[model samples]
Target: MLQLIIRRLLQAIPVLFLIATATFFLIHLAPGGPFHQERPLSPQVLEALNAHYGLNDPWIVQYGRYLNHLLHGELGPSYGHPGHTVNELIAQSLPVSIELGLWAWVFSLIVGIPLGVWAAEKQHRWFDRVCSTVSTLGLCLPTFVLGPLLMLGLAVGLGIGNVCGWGSWEDRLLPVLTLGLVHAAYVLRLTRGGMLEVLNQDFIRTARAKGLSGWTVLFKHALRGGLLSVVAFAGPQLSALVTGSFVVETIFHIPGLGRHFVQAAFNRDYTLILGTTLLYGALIIVMNLMADLMQAWLNPRLRVSML
Candidate 1:
């Protein structure tokens, strides 16, 4: 397990390098500079700002300099946010994103898994049909659309909560539900499929033949194997939840990394863009590694093969 983890980490170095390299050039090659604004700066001021941020350097030189700073654990200063390093901004915002992601994950699991298991158990019944229909709608609804609809119904029409801003539990509820429901739909489908497959296996028949109670057979005997797909999906889903909250964060005025990431891109804060991109890329790799580990743990044969 440790060897597998170490190997995955080692392999991530180049992947992250490629992501960073690609993002750096793409953002730099974009039409405007970070200092570009409605009011034109004096050429002297622009030149001074470029020199100060090393933006005046040749692309290759700037890349090399950025790489050097990266190797020494520096992410450089934020162009949009003066007097703040990219590192400090990320440090302030990452926890908020992480917290939001965790809440959404928990909501997805709680809502998705049980309904899926029940749907599988009840197969062509009314409950299954209802769940299937809801899951379909959930899958079809994009966050941007669903967010405002929810705000209209719950916040605007019903007067349930504030329309925007993130602070109280009410503020968090909409965002969490908006982010979680789509993923929950995915989880529901995966879980139902996995459980259906598992329940039809010969082992399940034998367990039934042994006269085990239905609940025991389902939960104890079949659930572990049934949940294999969900476990496999969990890592990437978690990372996506964290990094993909840009829309939700923006809508809710949440102070998270995603909001900053979106602002960085729009503002062309080169260092902040690179930092957030690399951070998200690294997160994706780590999450996939975790998924691989979880998959191996769930299947002993896979674990042995990994060894």
Candidate 2:
């Protein structure tokens, strides 16, 4: 398992490098400098700004310089902010994003797993139908739509939670709900499908014949295999949530890495853009690797395939 993990991490390096190369060039190719302003600067001032940031160099040279800096753990200064480095900005914001994502992940699992199991147990019944309908609605509703509705219904209507901004626990509830519900919908469907398949196995019948209570048979005997799909789905979603939800964060006015990524892109902050991209890219790779490992552990046959 350790060997598999090490191998996967090694494979991720080139994947990240190609991502960095493509992202770096595409961003620079876009028609705007980080220094571009509606109020044009004097040519000499512009030239000085370019030189200071090493933007005066050819694209290849600049990319090489950036790579060199990256190796030394420097993401370069933020062009949009006078004195802030891209690394510093991410360090400040990523924790908030991680916290938001973690809560949402937990929420999704708590709600989704049980709902899915119950729905599967009650398959073809009204309860199952209702669960399916709810999951569909969850799938259909984008964050932009759901977030406002939650705010309008809960925050403004019932005064349940704060509408926007991030400071206290109250401020985070809506955004977390908005994010968690969507993922929960995904998890629910996956869990239901996995549960249906697992429950049909001969082992489930044997467990039932042993006089195991329905709850024990379902939760203990069947649930482990039933969760395989959900486990597989969680890897990328974990990274996505942790990195931040751009729309959800924007709507909720949460100061997270996703919002910063969008701002950096709009501002054409080259280093900041690459930094966020790298951060997300790395997270995704690591998360997927973890998921793969978990999958292998759950099904020993998969460990053979991992080789």
Candidate 3:
């Protein structure tokens, strides 16, 4: 396991470098400078700003400087917002995103897994059909649409939670539900399919013939194998959770890193954009590694294959 983890980590290095390199060049190619505006600044003023921030340097030189700063764990200043560094902004905002993501993760698993199992157990019945329909609806609704509808139904009409903003527990309710439920639909579908496949196997019939309790047969014999699909899906799902939901965060006015990342892109805050992109890329790699490890532990055959 340790060797497998080390190997994965080693492989992630080049991927991170490529992400950083591509983001650096592409962001620079976009029209408009970080300091550019409808009203032009005096050339002297612009030159001074460029020189002070090293933006006047050649692209290769700038890339070199970026790498130097990045190596020291320094994400440089935010161009759109004067006097704030990328590091400071992320430190302030990332916690809210993580908090939101964690609750959503828990909510997804709790709601999706059991809902899926229930649907599969009652396959071909009304309950199964209803679950299938609901899952389809959930999958079809994008966060942008679902977010507003949730804001309207629960926040505006019922006044159950805050309409927008993030601080207390109440403010978190709508955002978590909106993001969690949508992702849960995917999990529900995967879990249902996996459980259904497992349940149809010959061993399931043998377990029944052995007169094992229905609950034991389902939970003990079937559930572990049934979760393979969910385990596989977890890597990307977890990365999305930890990174925060951009649409949900925006709709709710949550001050998460996701909102900042979007703002950086539009505002052309070069350092901020690159910082967030690289951070997300790294998170994705780490999450995938963790998922692979977990899957290997669950299935010994996977461990052998890794070896």
Candidate 4:
């Protein structure tokens, strides 16, 4: 297992570099540069600015220099926001994004797993039907649509929290709920389906034959095994929610890496955009690796194969 983990980590190096290179070139390929604006700048000042940032160099040379700096942990300066490095901006904004992501994942698990279990337990009953209906609706709604609707329902219509602001935790209520609710629905469906399948498996039947009480059979034998699938699914889903929260954050006006990423993209801040992308890619890759490890831990057969 340790060797497998080390191998995965070693492989991630090139993936990160590839992501960085792709981000660097894609940003440059856009019609104008970070310096380009609707209002023109003086040619002399532009030339000086270009020279200062090493934009005067050929594209390949500039990219090579950028990669070299990256190797040294210098992610470059903020293009539009002077007096700030890309790392500094990420440090400032990442907390909010991380907080949102944490809450979203928790909310997803709390709501989805239980609801799925309950639905599965009560299959063909009203509770199961209701959960199915709710999950369907959540799956259907886009976060952009859901965010405003939630704001309207909770903030405007119900007047529970502020509609827009980053002043307090209350401001996060609707956004977090909005971002998490849909993911919860997905998790619920997956957990219920997985649990139900486990319940019907041969081992579950054997446990029943051994006269184990229903609860013990369900919890000790079924739930743990069933949870393996859910845990694996949750990792990727959480990563998606974390990265995709940019839209939800923008709609809700939350101060997070997501919002900052969008802002950097709009401003053509190459370093900021590439740095953020690299960070996101690294995070997702790490989470996925962790999930794989967890799966092996849960199912010893996988662990044995790895060994």
Kindly report which residue stretches of model 2 are placed more than 4 angstroms away from their true locations once superposed: 209-211
Model 1 lDDT per residue over 187-283, tens place = 9998999999999999999999999999999998888888899988988889877864888888888888987777899999999999999988898
For model 1, the run of ten residues with the poorest summed lDDT: 158-167
lDDT of 2 by residue, 208-295 (tens): 9999999999998888899989998999899999999899989998889898788889989999999999999999999988888888
lDDT of 4: 0.86
Which of candidates 2 and 4 is the stronger one according to lDDT?
A: 2
lDDT of 3 by residue, 1-307 (tens): 7888888899998998899899999999999888887899999998899899989889999999898898899988989879999999889888999899989988998999999998999999999999999999999999899888988999889989986888788899999999999989999999999999999999999999999998999998888888988988977788788777778888899989898788888888999999889889988899888888888877778988888
lDDT of 2 at 150: 97
Best lDDT goes to which candidate? 2
TM-score winner among the candidates? 3
lDDT of 3 at 23: 96
**Pick by TM-score: 1 or 2, better one:** 2
Model 1: pairs clashing at backbone N, Cα or C within 3 Å: none
Model 3 CA lDDT for position 191: 93
